[model samples]
Structures are given as structure tokens and as C-alpha cells.
Target: MRIASLRQGAAVISEAGAHLLPMPVGDLVTLGLDRALEVGATALASEPVPYAEEDLLLPYRPASVRDFVTFESHVEGVRRSVDNASGVPAAWYDAPTFYFTNPHALYGPGAPIPRPASSRALDFELEVGVVLGAGGTSLTEREAGAAIFGYTIVNDWSARDLQSREMQVGLGPAKGKDFATSLGPWIVTADELPSLDLDCRVSVNGSLVGQDRLSHMNWTFAQMIAYASRDSVVVAGDLLASGTTGGGGCLAELWGRSGQQTPPPLEPGDVVTMEVEGIGSLTASVAVG
Candidate 1:
């Protein structure tokens, strides 16, 4: 079933139609988790309020967006273009590493992703991930799998100049990547997907920019969750971002020539759409002053 969190409020899709959920998406995911688990049923159904998709806010407000460097294509793309290197360092394969982002940074699809005047470079990072369900630490992979509710997309908007400046201090990305991140239309249960081999892509102003398969990820979701939960709890509404994929994901990589240059940078009129094969598409337009 497809579940959406919007300004009008939480909702889920059923045979009847789009139904309003009893509570907020985060609250529903974090709150009633134990109740749903206790029942041991396929899903929790509810009556939903009518809200226009465009007018609706969105399901973000994640407890946190724990980002991990797992997609190899993204890694390679960085190395070959942005990073002053050739490939991922030897230690990258040692284990999963992540950086946490505040939940308040959440934005919604169709909403304007601001391009700060403070810096001329602003960009998008196309990503997707598993939504962790209610649970505590020490849960085994089998248990983690059971706790998983579904998946959603993220546009990890970045301030390139700020990120580079902060990285110079060695603490890394601090307020740079914290400015904004968007997620929505909704979250779908894992049962809906035939396989995780979802084909995903990104387009700007209707022009294709990034396209690749999830099969290319250096690390899979199961491994990411297992490694992440080594000792900590993967809570009900906690989110994990599967980083970005390849080709033109961010301006940090597409700095020079290669026949790809976003001059005038990203103006207010620009529209970017991200598509994940199994899921659907999310489009966001750049807003100007």
C-alpha cells in the first residue's frame, strides 16, 4: 500500500481510495508501530481526508537522515570528477560510514529548492532508501527486515561553496548540506516492489541528466541496515539516505567541461524530476527571489 504524509495530514492507499491516516506520517510510523506489530497483520488501514497532491505539504520531518556513502557509481563519479583522486579509498569498503542531518531540513516535492545567493553553486543529489520501523537496538537482520515499512526518495540539496569551505576545517559538510533536503509524495511498503533492482533517473528542465540502476550501489540496503544496526537501534521513523547515483548529480562534480554545464546555474524556472523505477517520480522547481 502507498502511504503519503501531507500538509492536510497523513494518509494511506487502500482498495477504497486514498484514505487519511489517523496521525501524522512520522507519528504514525513512530507512534502506532507497536500496535501494528502486535496485530501481526499485513497493514494498518485508516480513513483519510481529501487533499490535493499539489496543495498537500509532504511526508518528511524524518527523525534524522543518516546518509551513507554506498553507491559505487556516485563514489566513482566523485573520484573521477569532483574529488582530486582516482577511486574510493581502501577504508571505504571496510564498513559503512554515515553523516546525520537534522529532520527540520525537510522540504517537499513541487516546492522550491532555494539556490542561496550566498553562493553561486547549488545542486541536487538524487537518492532513495528504506524507512526504518519501530524497534530497538540489537535486532538481527531478519528482525530489521521485518521492521522495514517501505521506501521513499530524497533530493539532498547542497551548497557547494559552503561544503567545500567546511570540509577545509576537517569536520565536514556541517551547515552546508544541512540547509535543505526534500522527500515525499509517499512511502510504499516493501511488498510492493518486485525487487530492489529499481531503475532510477534524474532530469532537469525535461533534459535527462542522471540515469542508472540501483543494482549499481556499492552497498545494498540490507547490508547498510545490518551494518548500521551493529549496536544502535534503527527506530520506527528513522531514515537512511542511499546517497546519490551517477552523472550530474551535483555541481561539485560537474565543475568543468565534458559538454555538461549548467550555466546561469539553476534559475527559478528550472524543474528537476527524479524517477525511481519501482516507486514513482518526484519533481521540484528552483525558486528565485
Candidate 2:
């Protein structure tokens, strides 16, 4: 089942339309994935509301956000953009690495993303994210896989100039990325997604910019989750993102490919739309912060 958060409340989307849930999505998720699915199913009996895209909100506020770089091609492309002879770091192949991001900075479908005032080189990363329904510490891959509740599209916005400088000091991507992150359209339950091999695409101001497949990731979501849970806890509502896809998932990767910025960086009034095959499209307009 597909669940969406609206100004009214949580909703279950069906062919007929969207049905409102009795409680908010964040609360439903706390009931655990199975019980949440049950609640969603029960909500289907309520009168349906027209599926108005503009009325949607972040599917649910994330408990915490952890983004991982699991795409080898993306890593290689980005590295080459920085240093001609560079390739994926040898350490990168040893484990699934991720960074924590601000969960409060999230925006939903149709929201306007604020470009940080300090950035002139803004970019977007197209990715797929999974929301967890169960929590655990030192989880096994199979256990982590079972904890997944559903999936959604994630637009991990970036400030290239800032990210570059901070990472050089060996510590960040912090201020560069803390400004904004767009998520939603809605979340499709794990059972609803039979395969991870889905097409992913992104566009800027109605012009196609990048395209790739979810299957391109070298490491699976389960592996990323298990790695994250190593002696630490990941709880319900936590979000984990599959880093940018290769084949032009982000402007940085594009610049890396061409050895220079081709299309200019995002400016005010730009519209970005990111889509994943089974989930849906997530669009956000760019605005000066």
C-alpha cells in the first residue's frame, strides 16, 4: 500500500483515490510496519479524497537521516572531477559509508527549496530512500532488510563550493548540505516494490538532466542498514538514502564528466523533479534562502 501525509492527516492511496488515516503517518509508523499496514488497510474503508498533488506534505518527519554512497560509478565520476587520475577510494569498497544529515531540513512535494545564501554552486542528487519501521543495534543484513517499512524519492541538495572546501579539512559536507532535502510524493510499502531494479530520472525546469537505475548501486539497502547498525541503533522513522546514481544523477557528477560546469548552477525560480519508477515524482522549486 502507498501512504502519504497531507495537511489533513496520513492517507492511503489507492486506484479509487486517497483515503485518510485516523492518525498522522509518524504515529502510524511507531505502531511498527505490520500494524501500520493494517491501519492503512483499514483506512481504505473511509470516503476517498481526490488525490491533489499540491496538498501533500513530507510523508512523515524523519527521525534521523543517514545518506550512503553505494554507487561506484557515481564515486568514480565525482573523484575524477576533482582529480584527473582519481578513482573510488580503496576504503570505500571495504564498507558502506554514510553521513548524518539534518532531519529537520526536509521539504515535501511542491515545496520551495531554499538555496543557501553562501552557495553559488548548488546541485541536486537523485536517489531512493527507505524508511525503517523497526529499530535495532548490531543488526544482521537479513534483520535490517526486514526492518524496512517503505521507499520514497530523495533529492539530496548540495552546495558544491562549500562541500569541497569543508571536506578538504577532513570533516564535512555540513553547512553545504544542511540547508535542504526534498522527500516525498509518498511512500510505497516494501511488499509493493518487488524489485530494486527501478528506473530513476531527474529534470531541471522541465528539461531532462539525469537518468540512472536503482540497480546501479554497488551495495544494497540491506547492507547499508546493517552497516549503520553496527553497535549503534536505528529506530522507526529513520531514513536511509541510496546515494546519487551514476550517469548524471547530480550536476557535480555532470561537471566531473565534462571537466567543467556545463549548465549553470541552480538559481531562484528553478523547478526540479526527481522520479523513481514504483514510488513517484518529487518536485521542488528553488528559491533564495
Candidate 3:
């Protein structure tokens, strides 16, 4: 079942429409996946209301956010552009790599994303995100996979110019990325998504610019979770993102391919729409901060 956090409250979405839940969506996460599914099924008996996209909110305020770079093509593309490297580093192939991002910077569907004041090159990353329904430390892949509660579209909005400068210091994509990130429409529970292979696409101002399949990832969400949980505690409501896809996931890849900024960076008022099959679309408008 699809669960959404609406302005009114938590909701269970069905083919007919959205049904209000007696509790907030965050409460459902605390209940764990099995119990949450049970509660969601019961909530579906309530009167259905139109699923107004604008009424949505972040499915829940994440306890923390970890974004993993699992797409080799994306890594290769950006590395060539930024470092002029021949290919991915050997260490990258050994394990899933990620960075902790600001959990407080989240926005929901239809929200306006502010372009960082210091940034001149703002870009959108098309990705798939999962919410954990159970907590564990040093989890195995199987255990980690079972911890997944649901999936959603993620836009890891980037200030490319600022990111480049910060990475030169040997740490951080901090201020470069901490400004904004988008998640929502809603979350489709793990049971509903038995397969991870899905088509992912992004469009800007109504023009289709990039597309990739979720199957292209070099690492699975399970691996990402396991890697993240190693000697660390990961709890319910934590957000994990499968980083930018290849085959045009972001403009940096485009620049890498062409060796110049072909399409200019995002400008105020530019609308970005990212969609992942089975989950849904998440669109955000760029605004001057």
C-alpha cells in the first residue's frame, strides 16, 4: 500500500483515493513495516478523499539521511569531467560509498527549492530512495533488505559549482548539498516493490533531459544499507538514497560528456520533474533563495 503524509494527517492511498489515517505517518514507521501495513490496510476502510498532490508533505521527517553512489556510469562520468580519471577507483568497487547529508533540508512535492545564493551551477539528481522500518547495527544484506519500509523518488539537488570547490578540501559536499533535497508524493511500501529494476527519468521545464534504469546500479540498496549499518546504528525513519543514475542523470554527466556546459545550470523558476516507475513523480520549482 502507498502511505502519504498529508497536510491533514497521515494517509493510505489506494486506487480509489487517499484515506486519512488516525496517526501521523511517522507513527507508522515506529510501528515497523508489518504493523504499519496492517494499520494501513485498516485505514483504507475510511472514506476516500482526492489525492491532491499539493496536500502532500515529506512522508516523514527522516531521523538521518545517507546517500550512496551506486551507479558506476555516473561515477565514471563525473570523475572524467572533474578528475580526468580513466575509470572508477578500485576502492569504489569494494563497497558502496556514501555521505551523510542534511536531514533538515528536505522538501516535499510541488515545493519550491531554493538555489543556494553562492551557487551559479545548480543541478538535479534523479534517484530512488528508501525509508527504513526497522533499526539494526551491523546488519547483514538479508537483514538490511528486510528493514526497508518503502520507496520514493529523490531529487538530491546539487550546487555543482559549490560542490566542486568544497570537495577540493578533501571532505564535504556539505554546503554544496545541504541547501536542498526533495522527497515525496508518497512512499510505496517494500512489499509492493518486489523488483528494483525500474525506469527513472528527469525532465526540466517540460523537456525530457535525462533517463536511466534503476537496474543499472552497481550496488543494491541492500548493500548500501549493510555498508551503512556497519558498526553504526540505523533506525526506522532513516532515509537512504540510491545516488544519481547514469545515462544523463545530472548535468555534470552531460558536461563530462561534452567537456563544456552545454545546457546552462538551473535558473530561478525552472521546474524539475523526476519519476521512477512504480513509485511516482516528484517535481520542484527552482527559486532564488
Candidate 4:
């Protein structure tokens, strides 16, 4: 069943729509989405309330957010664009690489994303995100796969110029990315979304600018999760992103090929929509702060 965090409490989404329920006593921060999903129908204390996608918030705040770069094509393209001699390194193939992102700053569907005042190069990274169900440490691939509760679309909104500058210092994507990360529409329980062969696409203002398949990721979610859980606990509500797909996943990759002047970075008021088959779509407008 699809679970969503409602204004009043937690909700179980149906084919017809959302059925609101009060969260059991205790803060969701402590209880986590894993326990909520385990409670299942028992959490619904009332009849279904009036609900719409826009009225909902992020399915839940993640306990922690780890985004992985699992796509070789994306890495190759990015490396080739900047330093042609360097390709996907041997270390990258040895293990999946990832970075921790700000979990405090998040947005749900339809939320207006404020343009970072420091960025002239704004872009979007289309990705699939996994939300863990149960808590575990040093989990094997099988154990990690079982811990998964659901999946959602992740719009890892990026400030390209800021990211490039910060990486040069070898310490961060910190302020460059801390502003916002958009999630939701809703979570699709893992059982329901068994296939990884989904089509991924992104459109800006009415044009299809980025399109690819989720199957392009060289490292599977299982490997990424296992690596993340090594000697460390990954509790319920922890988020793990599958990183960007190749074939024009973001403006940095696109602009690198087409030139910054041709397609231009995202401007205020531009509407960006990203979709992954089966999970649903997330759309937001760019607004200047």
C-alpha cells in the first residue's frame, strides 16, 4: 500500500485517492515510516479525509539522505566534458560512490523552489529514490533489499556553478546543494514497483529535454544500500537515491554538449517536470527568493 504523510497524520493512498489517519502517539521522527507501514490499516483512526496531491507533504522526512552516483554513463559524460583524459576511474568500478545531502531542507510536489541567489547555472537531476523500511546495520544485499519500504521520484535540484566551484576545494557540494531537494507526489510500496526497467524523463516548460531509462545505473540499489549500511545503521525513513541517468539527465551534462548559450540555465518561472514510470511525476516552478 502507498503511504503518505498528511497534514493531520499519516495516510494510506488508495486507487481512489488518500485515506487520512491519525499518527499513533509519539513523534514521527522517532516512530519512523517503517513502523507506520508495519502498523498498516490500524493507523487509520478515521474515515478518509478530503485529499489532493498538492495538500500532502513529503511522505516523511528521511532519517538521513545518501545519494549515489551509480550510472557510468553519467560519470563518463561529466568527466569527458571537463577533463577529457580522465574517464570513469578504476575505484568507481570497485564500489558505488555517494554523498550525503541535507535532509533538513526538502520540498514536496507543487512547492515553489526558490532560485539560489548565488547560482547562475541552475539544473535538475532526475533520479529514483528508495526509502528504507526497517532498521539494520552491516546489512547484506538480501537484507538491505528487504529493508526497503518504498520508492519515490527525487529531483536533486542543483546549482551547477556552485557545485563546480565547491568541488574544486575537495570538501563539498555543501551550500551548493543545501538549499532544497524535492521528493514525493507519493511513495509506491516496493512490492508494487518490482521492475527496474522504467522510462525516466524530464521536461522543462513544455519541451522534453531529458530522457533515459532507470536501467542505465551500473550499480544496483542493493549494492548501494549494502555499502551504506556497512557497520552503520540505516533506519526507517532513511533515503537512498539512485543518482542521475545518462542521456541528458541534467542541464550541466546537457549544456556541456550544447553550450550554455544554446539551452540556457533554468530561469525564474520555468516549470520543470520529472517522471519515473510507476512512481508518478513531480513538477515545480522556479521562483526567485
Candidate 5:
């Protein structure tokens, strides 16, 4: 089932279209979305509300956010673009590697991402976000798979200049990435989206820029979740993101290799639209600080 958190209330999008549940938006968050779904199932559904009429919010307020780089093509593209000596590290193939991001910085669909005052090289990452249901430490891949609640589109906004400088110190992307991370349209339950193979695409200001298939991922979401849950709890509402897909998924990868100058980095008033086949599309406007 498709679930959306709106400014008005929690809703379920069915073949009949968007039907509001009686539950208040904040109460749905406090009750846990999974449980809210259960309650909404049997309750008298209200009249279908046109989706565009209501203001949407982030489907889940994540307990924590973890993003992983599982696309080998992205890694190779980065190395080639930056002229780095080392390719993807040998240890990367053995285990999935990830970094924690600022959970408080997440934005919903239609939100504006302000270009950090310190950054000029602004970029967007097109990805899929997996939201966990409940799981404990050291989960097996199967266990982790069962713990998944749903999926959503993620646009991990990046400040390439700040990111590159900070990585040189081997510590953080703290200021580089903490500015914004966008998710939504709505969350599609795992049962509704059983396959991971989906077409992912990105466009800026009406022109297509990046496109790739999720089937090409070198590491699966199950593995990423299992690795993340190792010796740590992955509770309901925790978010894990599949990193950018291959091809020209981001400006850093595209311009970095081709030296193309026609399409420039994001500027204020630019609209970024990201779509992953099953989850849906998310669009955000850019604003410079």
C-alpha cells in the first residue's frame, strides 16, 4: 500500500485515489507508521482527497540516517573524474561501507534546498531510501530483509567543494552534506514494491541529465542493512539509502569525466526532479544562501 504523510493527516493511496485516515499526522508518527497502517486498514476511510491538494511531508522522521556507496560504476567514475591514483579500495568489495548523515536535516517533497554559503559546487544524488521496521544487532541478510517497512526516493544534496576538502582530512563531510537531504512524494510499502530492479533518473530544469537501472547495483539493500545492523539496533523508522546509481547520476560524475560545460552546477531557481520507478518522483527547488 502507498502511504503519505500530509500536513492535514495520514493517507493511503489506493486504486480509488488518496483516502484520508482519521489519524492525525503527528499521531501517526508517534504511533509508528507500521502500526498506523494496521489501524487505518479497518477504519472507515474518508472521501478521497486529491493528492496535489494537500501539502506533503517526509513520510518518516528517521531515527538515524545511513547512506552507503554500493555502485562500483560511481566509484570508478569518481576516481577517473578526480584523477586519483587508487581506484575503489580492495576492502570495499569485501564489505559494504557507509557513512552516517544528519537525520535532523531531512526535507520533504517540494522543499527548497539552500545552497550552503560556503559551497559553490552544489550537486544532487539520485537514490532509493529503505526504511527499517524493527531489528536488533547482528541481523542476517534474511532477517534484515524482513525488517524493511518500505521505500522512498532520496536526493542526497552535496556540496562537492566542501566534501572534497573534508575527505582529504579523512574525517567528515560534516559541513559539506549537513545542509539538506530530500525524500518523498510518498513511501511505498515493501509488500507493494517487491523488486529492487527499477529505472532511476534525474533531470534539471526540464532536461534529462542522469539515468540508470537499479539492477546494476553491486551490493543489495539486504546486505547494506545487515552490515548496518551489525552490533547495532536498527529500529522502526531508521533510514538506509542506496547510493547514487551508475551512468551520470550526479554532476560530479558527469561533468567530472566529460568536462562538459553546457549544463552547469545548480543555481538558485533551478528545479531538480529525481525518480525511481517504484517509489515515485521527488522535486525540489534550489536556493542559494
Candidate 6:
């Protein structure tokens, strides 16, 4: 069963039909499959359901969100792009790593993305995100699949210069990224996007910026979850984005800003569209004052 957030509330989509449900994004997340069925039946209406698309929203409302950088090529490209001292540390290869962000970033599709007034070099990372189904610790790789609920498109908006300046301390982006990030029109269940292989792309306005397949992640979801569960707990509705892909990913990758001859900074009014093959596209229109 697939669940989606719409303007009216929440809705369940299945072979039988669609029904309006009143469950919050967190509840279905924590409750898992049982809750999904319960809410579906309980919220089923006696009348026929409508099938309009405008009212739909992304299926993310996690208690928290953590996006990881799982592509080695992305790391290498970014290093050269931003003039970093060297490649990612060897520890980064030992296991998966992640950074948290706001789960409230359920910006509706077509929502205009803000151009941070503090930034001159803004970029977007096109990624595939996984939604955890329940709380778990020391989760095994085999068991990790059961903990998944679905997948969605994630755009990790970035301010390149700010990210570079802060990383030397070994922390990160802070205000460099506190601006805005975006996710989803719907969360396609694990069963829905069964195959991990899918084509992904990042386009600026009508021009292509980055395009790659989802198969390139240095660390897979199962591995990340397993590694994460060893020390900390992953709960239902916790989202993990699989980071950016190869070339055409972020501006930091495409144009080596501080290292090579710099390209003209991205002007305000630029629109970025990122899409995954099975899921959907996330479109952001950038603007600055």
C-alpha cells in the first residue's frame, strides 16, 4: 500500500481504491504496515473517491532526517571543485556517514526555492531517500530491508562557498545549508521501487547539469542502516538520503570554483529540476533579493 499526504489530509492508494485518512505523517511511520492497513479501513469512505493530483504532497514527515554522502566520485569531484586540501579521509570509506536536517522540509512540488542571500555559489544534489519503518538497534543487513517503508527524491540544496569555509574545522555547512532543502510529491514504498537501479538527473532550467544512475552509491541503504544501528537507533519515519551521484551532481562538482578558472556564479532566477527514474521530479526555482 502507498500512502500520500494531500491538501485535505492523508490518503491510502491501493488496488481496491483510494481513501481519505487522518493519520499524521509520524504515526504511519512509527506504526508501520499495521497502522497503514488500520487507517486505510478506518478512514475508508462510503462514497467514491476522487483521483486528482494537485492536492497531493510528499510522504515525508519524519521525526528527523539524515542525508549521507555515499558516492566516492562525488567526493573526489567535489574536492577538486571546491579546492579542498585532499580527498575524503580513509575513515569515510570504513563505513557510511550521515548528517541530519529538518524533517519539516516537506516543501510542496513547484514551491519556489529560495536563493540564500548569503550565497553566491548555490547547487543541488540529486539523491534517492529511504524511509525507515521502525525503531531498531544493531540491525542486521538482512533485517534492514524490513525496516524500510519507501523511497523518494531528495534535493540537498547547497551553498558551495559556505560549505568549503566551514569544513576545514571538520564540522560542516551550518548556515551554508540552513537555507532550504526539498523532498517529494510522494514516497514510493520499498515494494514499489523494488529495483534499486534507476536513472537520475539534475537539470538547471532547460540545461542538463548532472545525470547518473542510483546504482553508484558507495554505500547501500542496507549497509548504512546496519552500520548506523550498531551504535545508534533508527526509528520509524527516519529518512536517509543516498547522497549525490557522479558528474553533473552539485555545482561543486561541475565547476571547480576555488581551484580552476571559476565559471560565472549562478544568477538568481535559476530553476533546478532533479528526478529519479521510478520516483518523481523535485523542482526548485531560485531567487535572491
Candidate 1 clash pair list: 7-57, 19-48, 20-47, 20-48, 133-236, 134-236
The TM-score values for the models, in the order shown, are: 0.86, 0.97, 0.97, 0.89, 0.91, 0.87
lDDT of each: 0.70, 0.88, 0.88, 0.78, 0.80, 0.74
Candidate 4 minimal-lDDT segment of 10 residues:
24-33
In model 4, which runs have C-alpha deviations exceeding 4 angstroms?
24-38, 42-47, 80-86, 259-261
Better of 1 and 5 by lDDT: 5
Q: How accurate is candidate 3 locally (lDDT)?
A: 0.88
Where does the lowest 10-residue lDDT sum fall in candidate 1? 36-45
Judge candidate 1 at residue 205 and give its lDDT: 90
Model 5 vs. true fold: TM: 0.91
Screening candidate 5 with a backbone cut-off below 3 angstroms (N, C-alpha, C), the clashing residue pairs are none
lDDT of 5 at 242: 89
lDDT of 4 by residue, 1-289 (tens): 6677766557777765566655521233245445655655564444666776667777778879998988877777655443332467888888888899999889988888987898887888898998876768889999888777778999998887777777777775777788889998777778788888999999999899889999888877888899998978788778899998888887767655654534678999999999889888889889855
Q: What's the candidate order when arranged by decreasing TM-score?
A: 3, 2, 5, 4, 6, 1
lDDT of 3 at 286: 97
TM-score, predicted candidate 6 vs. hidden true structure: 0.87
Candidate 2 stretches greater than 4 Å from native:
82-85
Model 3: per-residue lDDT, tens digit, 1-289? Answer: 8899987788998889889998888888878899998898888988888867878898888899999999988998877665555678899999988999998889999889998888888999998998999989999999999899999889999988888877788785788889888999898999998988899999999999899999998888888999899999999999999999998899888888888876778999999999899998899999754
Model 3: which residue pairs collide?
Answer: none
Residue-level lDDT of model 5, residues 1-289, one tens digit each, is 6778877667887767667877653344445546866866744266676667238887768888998888887877655544343367787798878889999899999988999987778889988888876767889999888778788899989887788777777774678788899989887878787778899999999899999998888887888899998987787778898888878788878766665533577899899998889888899999745
For candidate 4, list the clashing residue pairs, or say none.
none
